[model samples]
Target: MVVIAKQNVVDILLMEAFYEMHQVRDRLNFFQEKYQQTFENFSVFMKKENENFEYFDDYMEWKAYTKLFDEVLKKIEELKNGNFQIALTALR
Candidate 1:
């Protein structure tokens, strides 16, 4: 049998949360790059078609993803500050 203390459990959970946040950070960077590349390609296509690329400035897909990415970043910060307990409670 294995034994673990309450503090140890909290520490372990914190470590896992930190790892998850790191992964989220990586995903955020990846998506940002992907979106930039796609947008650039789209702009090139619009220019070829003689369309105004400025209309994409208010693109809904881009806006929604940007908001979601920001939220993920904020969640990472909250997890870093040890608010996982509160978060877990909220989940329950």
Candidate 2:
């Protein structure tokens, strides 16, 4: 397992979710699907979870806030829908 520095992880939360968002978007685009709506929904959920915690909360706390300690259903939902272009754009 790789250990991400606490600070770097925070930066990701603030910005790097693009990678994850792209991962989800790419998977959706692959199947030629119709779930762009799903990504919006999951993004909403992720926002809510993050809202519960501080933006720069400690690593463990931020993970918990993001529900990373839980099922991470939002990420799954986004990935399942497939909209790689959106995900990629988010990264940039």
The candidate maximizing TM-score is 1
Clashing pairs in 1: none
For model 2, the superposed segments whose C-alpha errors exceed 4 Å read: 1-9, 33-92
The stretch of ten residues in a row with the least summed lDDT in candidate 2 is 83-92
Candidate 2: lDDT over CA atoms? 0.44
TM-score per prediction, in order, is: 0.39, 0.25
lDDT of 1 by residue, 32-65 (tens): 5755655445446545654345445534455555
User: RMSD for each model, in Å, please?
Assistant: 7.3, 17.4
**Per-residue accuracy of model 2 over 1-92 as CA lDDT, tens digit each:** 46656555445453545555565445545322432344335455556675544323333333343444123445444434542232223333
